[model samples]
Target: MCGIVGAIAQRNIVPVLVEGLKRLEYRGYDSAGIAVLDTEIKRVRRVGRVAEMEAAANEINLTGRLGIGHTRWATHGGVTEPNAHPHVSGDLIAVVHNGIIENHDEKRQALQAKGYQFESQTDTEVIAHLIHSYYVQDRNLFSAVQKAVTELVGAYAIAVIAKDQPDVLACARMGCPLLIGLGDGEHFVASDVSAILSATRRVIFLEEGDVAELRRDQILILDKDRQKAERKIHVSDVSLASLELGPYSHFMQKEIHEQPKALSDTIEPLLEAGFVPELFGANAKELLSKVDGVLILACGTSYYAGSVARYWLESIASVPCQVEIASEYRYRDAVANPNWLVVTLSQSGETLDTMEALKYAKSLGHDKTLSICNVRESAIPRSSEMVFYTRAGAEIGVASTKAFTTQLLALFALTATLAKIKGRLSDTQEQSYLDALRHLPGSVQHALNLEPQIKIWADRFAPKEHALFLGRGVHYPIALEGALKLKEISYIHAEAYPAGELKHGPLALVDDNMPVVVIAPNDVLLEKVKSNMQEVRARGGELFVFADLDSHFSESEGVHVIRTPRHAGVLSPVVHAVPVQILAYHAALQRGTDVDKPRNLAKSVTVE
Candidate 1:
């Protein structure tokens, strides 16, 4: 996923573009560039962060009334200055793109046959040439862009600026995210809302195959059929300053500590009023009542949240549940039940694989689609029959922290509602769950209080090359999430097992050199997991256990124990996720790795 920001305003827009890119840097950071249209197309690009691009633009004193910028994550080519965005054609047209063009090679060959030379090895550069080829025939930037886009065959959110049309910007979106920000005597376009949050809160979310013409005073949109269309502008409730790392060392740590507030916001509506199915949508109760089974499609951390929900849905709601990795879900010839509720979980709501999976499910006669996402007006939410929004705000860190817990909160609420609807839970049971929801924010805060001691454990883990995370019952997904965080940020090789499976084959890898972390909450399976820990200790494996307050585990020669807060039954997974996040953050900090922008990872997976 890359970030794109464009502006058409009365004054010089170089500073505005750079500031927007800075706010949207979490989307990508491999390289950044900007192209401004004044007397001619002036451009500067760097094979580094946006800060480097800003410095280069300053050194050259680049200025213009309208401009477009991009921060790239490198899709088709390597991260080099020439491969950066703001690619130009014959010094007149400049283009910035965010997605892959599958037919770029074929288009490039056609352009080359016309005696057009290519300067960089990128799919984006072909777009500039293709637009230029169209502009030569019509001399109209908007018409040229629309004609050129009709020939392309993949996902893209692109912005093009012409030297002749200095006051105009043309942009389009197909299978990727692009939107317009409404302003007074100025207009903006960006891949994300956070980039333009400082300038304006009012925005128009462009639909698929929509083209926009942005000028200083007005924005005109055209539908896929080349006809004028109207779109509603919605105001965002998110504040601009929340995007900043206020008083925190890194975004990861800030997000980890923000879990309490995130949880509070997510569960506040559910706790305030009694369980109402309309919280999801108008006819949510009717749709949920007709459902007999649940199918979850998600990727990465969101999949782990679904895994935990699988346990709750099956046990508490008496509903059969299945979880599938979104990337692999659409490729298989799996059977789809029409009565099944297909639920997709994503933080950005624009994850390509998950979106594709949702489409596939709907094609197979599963029209009852629901989305659990943090964003309100994203692709998945717009395509769903109902949506449950997680109020986690912006999670800038590539590795998810607060978003995961908030997803769990929403899923837990869904589970309780389903249980009550099915008469599987009594009023007393519902009240108990509600009381636990009221106490969850404080429970997460208590978990954060353990960070000082987790730092000591992280100190020991920083030098280790590999780690094993073990859990049993519903906590197995927690172990998986923990291993993923460790590997994602710390760059440490890690794996997770069900603890009972350790002796199956993983026991051979555990020894004095490898550290084994156990999720030993005081539940029914605690004794079974303890036996598994004994098996590890017998093989000379060092152990770190996160036990509940009442668990009878003490520190020994090689076993380190950190007592967690009291358990909250079905909500234990949410509480357990905090220590895992803190451990990963502190471990990466001690290891001197980039915590916010990990190598070869982007915050959102918008492309395949």
Candidate 2:
């Protein structure tokens, strides 16, 4: 996803815009730029990180009372200087936009026919030209932006400033997350709350199709119907520490170690107060009673989390569960059950594909929706019928660490709650599950202790180009998550297969050069998975097994085993996820790649 930050203030706002982009660097960007309204439109665009943009801004003494900045994750064009954001239209309007304009080509064609030329191959540039066309007619930037957005078709959050209007900033949102940050003698707009967290604690979350007019001291919002609207300004509780590295070399490393506290924060209240239907929402009890099955729609790491939950939901809750990739699910038709609860999982809660899929599900009459997300008040959760927040704090890493584990814990809670609600779980089972959850923080801490050993294992993994992850039963998804982590941050080609499937086709690729990693928790299928390990070993493939304490696997010449902190039984998937995260972190560190902001990936998928 791209990051957009803008300000209308009494003083020079370049510093604020630059700082906001720095805060958003973790979201992953290939190019950064800023445009300020000074005597004329002063612009500095760079095809690199935010620091480069900041350096260029400082070197040129770029300053203005109103400005917009952006870090682009290239949607319509390549990562080049001309493709960077803060795209301008003949020095009249500067626009920074996030999201793909679905009809950008048609709009560009229509504009070209009107004798307007284009500079860069970006959908964002068309937005500036379109706004300029409207501003030329009325000389009103606010009204011009509103009129331009009405003509565009796609999901977008955009901030625009006109050369004629130096005191106002106009922004709008549709099917994407955007909000206004309230400040003294200054007002701001950003795609993510984290971008402006340092500038203002108070914010107004704009609804879909809402347009905002920001002045130095006031923020006027217009609702979807073009009527003046008043949105609530809540004081954000996210700490500035979420953006800090704090004792760690990288945000990914910091987030990897933060899992223990994140797990504790996610499960403590529910475990201490007891699992009631009201934990989800006021109508959650009734919703749970009428629910027939679960259909989980997610992407990336969250999709793997949902896959892991499918096993628990079937075994513990006795509910049929299905996991689908949100990107694909949105385009395909399937049997929709009105009583089947549709659950969406995300860390940012603003993932565009998942959000759109949620809408598509509702279009088919599946309104019983639930969100398991980390963000407090994000788009998906706000749109869902019920929400269970995963308090993993702010996950800045492109490769997820604390958020994935926290989602697993939240899914585990949902599984237990549904089990108890349907009488599938007994009183003794609830207490036992609660006790294990209470001790989970300590188990996670012990898993963190494996970092030293994982670093050593990463040394071995660094020189390898291919890896195969193997698992069975409930641990299969854990293997998939591990392989995803390995490839995402480490850049190694990796794939996962169910251990039983090795003989079917995957064995043909096994060799001495290929590293085979197995998730062998001491569960019912431990022996079965071990037998699969032998098949890899017979093919002279080096094996890396993530085993539990009592699993009795040893470190031999070809067989390397890293034991987790005992095992959490049904919660073992949550525990096994930690070592993989640490392994991926250390592996990326050894390979000298960007761990927090992986190449070709952004922290949030805000566009499709």
Candidate 3:
């Protein structure tokens, strides 16, 4: 998951490219680089944050009408200046890539035999060499790029600039995302709309195997065979204010605190739209009404949200639901039934595995494909038969906070809709669930109030290298989400165990050095989770808990409890998730890690 931005302006565009790179910095930050073609050669590449790269580029001459910039999340190479993107060939063909070449080894071997020496240990270098090789034979940049891409396998969204064709930039996408922005006397291309949001609202989302030849005043779309193709231009609705952290310390913390608004945004639209029939349209409602089961595919935090939703779907809707990790779902020999509804969850909406899984399910004739996503007009939503959008705004943190909660909110709303559609819940029950859904915004606000206390608690546990998260029943998935977030951003060795499963194997890891975080929300399993906490305490493991308000636990004991408001069985997962997010945020802060741009993590996993 890397961010790529390119611009061909009527005037010097280095500042615009740098600004756009900064906006897209949340996607990746291991290294940043820019290549601009002007009267002479100007290139700046560095192995650090965007700010570092910008500082280095400031001292150089950045005058250019066309440029491309990249913030890399390393794949197939180490994080170094030589490996950073905007790789150039000997003839000054600069390129920025966002995906891995699966057949790079074969391509590199052939190129090496032809006396093409590689400088970097990246699959992306193959693209530069291949393009250079084709240009040497064809002498046409666009035709050379098309020919080179025909030989490549795996996902890629690549933008290339040649010194001979400084007025033009050619871009192509396979499995990865690439967008072309239509601006006044200029053109822009980026991996996502966030990079070009400030410069242009009109964007042309390139489909797989589509290439665009962008110039300062025009853009042309072409197919794999270089045939002309029509393109649709979509106007983005993103606001500049959504990218700011506002009053929060980091994007992660700001997103954590924004859960209340995010939930409200997701719920209000559905409530105002009535029920399932109105939200999913006639086709989706007809299909969902006869669905026998649901299979959800997602990755990381979104997968954890699906785990929690599985319980809700089974319990409230009386539908058998299975949650599968998208990265592994396609590789397995799983059965797909005609009555099965395959749902995919994604925050950026461009997650590669989730998109591939959706396509695979559709290929199996499971037409009832639904997507739960936050970003509108994303790849997943475009490919699904129906889509439920979560209005979580812009979640810039590499470790997701708001996106997870909003996904849960959307899934819970869908569960309620499905329950009503199936006639499983009575009027009073539906009313009760609806009322609870309305009250969630306030409950999330109450959870946000615990941030200061969590920060204080974080100071005590941040020094520890290992931790454990435990929960029972529905809270078990919440514990898993918590542990995933902690491990993702803080680089902590954390594990999540169902409280009941601790005795099986995880209990052996408990010691005084291990800080165990227990999700003990008051429910039927509260006592069970408490007993598990006591077992950890007996083994000399320090405890941090998000307990129910009415749970009977001594406050002055060794246990650290962050009390959550008492809620119904299904609602506790949404409430209990907030504190764990806060814990991860504060812990990362205390450890002095880059909370927003964590190491080895990207906001969107665009490449499989």
Q: Specify the highest-lDDT model's number.
A: 1
Please, what are the lDDT tens digits per residue for candidate 2 over residues 1-608? Answer: 88999998888889999999988876657999999999789999998899998998999898999999999898888999988988999889999999989999999999999998988999999999999999999899989988999998999999999888998899999988898999989999998888888789999999999998999977789998899999988899999987899999998889988988999899877886677788889899999898889999999999999999999999999999999999999999877999999999999999999999999999999979999999878899999999999999988889988999999988888888889989999989899999999989899899999889889999999999999999898889988999999999999999999999999999999999999989999988988988999999899999998999988888888999888988789999889988988888888899999888888999989999
lDDT of each: 0.93, 0.91, 0.87
| Clash list (residue pairs), candidate 3 | none
RMSD of each: 0.9, 0.9, 1.5
Candidate 1: tens digits of C-alpha lDDT, residues 1-608: 99999999988889889999998888899999999987889999999899998999999899988999999998988989999999999887899998889999999999999988998999999999999998988678998999999999989999999989987899999888999999999999999999888889999999889999998888889999978999988998878768889999999999999999999998889988756787788879999988899999999999999999999999999999999999999999989899999999999999989998999999999988899999989999999999999999989999999999999988888888888888888989889998998899998899999999999999999999999999998999999999999999999999999999999999999889999999999899999998999999999999999998878999998899998888777799999999999999999999999999998999989998
- What are the per-model numbers of colliding residue pairs? 0, 0, 0
Candidate 2 residue pairs that clash: none
**Residue 189, candidate 3: C-alpha displacement in angstroms:** 0.4
Cα lDDT for residue 104, candidate 3: 99
TM-score of each: 0.99, 0.99, 0.97
C-alpha-based local distance difference test score of model 1? 0.93
Pick by lDDT: 2 or 3, better one: 2
Candidate 3 matches the true fold with a TM-score of 0.97
True lDDT of residue 133, candidate 2: 93
Name the regions of candidate 3 deviating beyond 4 angstroms: 224-226
